[model samples]
Target: MTTEDERMARFARTPAGQRGYDAAEVDAFCERIAAAFQGSTMLTAAQIREHEFAAAAFGHHGYDRDQVDDYLDRACVDLEYARRGDSPHPGPERLSPRDVQRLRFSAPPPGRDGYAAAEVDTFLDVVAATLAHAGPTGLSSQDARAIDFCPAEPGGPSYYADEVDAFLDVVVRTLTEQEQKHTAS
Candidate 1:
């Protein structure tokens, strides 16, 4: 089997003229990830989930951002399961209040259609508050499912709809699990 170093060495580079993550920074972080897998480092899944790298300098090609992010997501999940001594494959994990509070979505390119940023942020605030309270005085999973944001005005600031929607799925599952636990007690 290929080692982590070998796998990361093959990460795709951004196209010429396109900015991407700083290659050196990503490589350093990947080294930490590899160390974590080997039990030589203390990197946590949350750290992996929240890690960010600077953009490559002008005229420098960098690793593809999307590719790195997807790999990090899988790595985060794997690390979490590994810590739990569980199966390598895991379902979506629940989020804590802090996790919800820290969530962010990338904006679409200028002039592209997307969800209004303010609406999504406000809703996340409510979700975080609810989670912080452990299922009282907040929204239910169904409520979250029914929520909607206005379309961003043409050329205005907005969050990518797909990213927000995927995050909502996680939020809904978390809330649903909380509600079930609350009712069971």
Candidate 2:
């Protein structure tokens, strides 16, 4: 087996009494992931992101849930680059939907102006969806550049403008790079 194959199979199982992802289901999924890596199957990043596994408990202890999720998150990024005919190794600059999902920004200090919390969060959800299923029909870098959230009303919850803009820049660059690669091919 290749290094990637070993990696896929290396997820630790949950302890004896704890609930975790079903071992059988996770193992089967890993086999599919390995097949995809070997170019024997077609599996998109979105599919990886959306996959669900049954839960296991007691003597049937399953794989650690966090480990499986984290590994799958990385696999989705690598698979996305592979699908684009780019190097199979996703560069550090690439942003997976998981990355976007985990992003958190500090709320602005009292009396400071910032983007509306709900609006920014909503936009981020769209951005994550775009990354998960990017295509001609999905949101593009241009769309990201054009997004303008409403400013938070005074005393209302808000995200720091600088942080939001920085993250948006990263999103734009990631989308633009993906588009470039697709066009080049």
Candidate 3:
């Protein structure tokens, strides 16, 4: 089996270019990831999966965002599964790769009409408000994290699935941790 050092040494460094992500930031993040793999850092899979760097619109060449993001996705998945295997918790699941994409949810079936735009929007608004802890009543941090939504009716004012999935994953993580604490206590 190839050693961790060997595996990481093969990482392709991104080229500097314009309109790409900041090379320094990307490199820094990769270093952290490598450290995690070497058992010297405590970074989590979610952190890796959600990592973002500002775009580099300044110079001639920069690290490619598509390549970086794809690589990160693979790394995050590998790390998540590895960690999950070590956890005592049952049924641990990782997010699907498609979950991060800007996907267009399918529309209503053949003859069926779309959901009522007003009601759908209202529901989404409520969810957003609750997640943001805006109103007097909202989803508990755990509920926010655990909550999942199907794609909105593919007609009027549909929300982006990728955005909602990402937000809800964060929420679920928060809520699940709280639940674990409560259970332990």
Candidate 4:
């Protein structure tokens, strides 16, 4: 059987490295340390350092600030659970990765639609108010001429709607294609 040192070396070579230990072992260690720290309102820098050492030993190693922040956040969450006498194990009760992905891809919320509507109304209202205040000075002669001659609908030859729409369509298409390419990768 491979020794612990050999296992650690092999783990370091893998993509997951030291942060991919069996969940049960990781959870148990977290629970024990959390219980020890229970009822403490705040941790000193030394206490944080000691917890960081224990975290590294428990396979939560990371070099980047964001990764370290996430590890620390999870540590706090586990501590809170332990303090409440909750099960320390991350079991089937936890949301699956597939569920998380589904939520991310879900349609925008109703509040988002309301926000968009409000923004568009505000923009149009501002434009209208500016035109009203300027009377005719705000508009160039060409703009006034176009307003007088152009068809009320947006698709006449005098109107630039088709060109504007085409440009917007191309932008949307390019962005969607880029997103698809990244998701495929």
- In terms of TM-score, the best-performing candidate is 1
RMSD of each candidate relative to the true structure: 11.9, 14.2, 16.6, 21.9
Q: Kindly indicate the candidate among 1 and 2 with the higher TM-score.
A: 1
Cα-based lDDT for every prediction: 0.73, 0.74, 0.50, 0.32
The digit string of per-residue lDDT tens for model 3 on 1-77 reads 11253145333434654477777777788778777766777876556655778876565466766677655655554
User: Which residue pairs does candidate 3 place in steric collision?
Assistant: 16-61, 16-62, 17-61, 17-62, 142-175, 145-171, 145-172
Residue pairs clashing in model 4 are: none
Report model 4's TM-score to 2 decimal places. 0.22
TM-score comparison, 2 vs 3, better candidate: 2
In model 3, the runs with Cα more than 4 Å from the true position are 1-18, 86-185
Candidate 1 vs candidate 4, TM-score winner: 1
Looking at model 2, the pairs that clash are none
lDDT of 3 at 150: 49
Question: How big is the positional error of residue 124 in model 2, measured in Å on the Cα after superposition?
Answer: 0.8
> How high is the lDDT of residue 20 in model 2?
92
Candidates by lDDT, descending order: 2, 1, 3, 4
lDDT of 4 at 137: 34
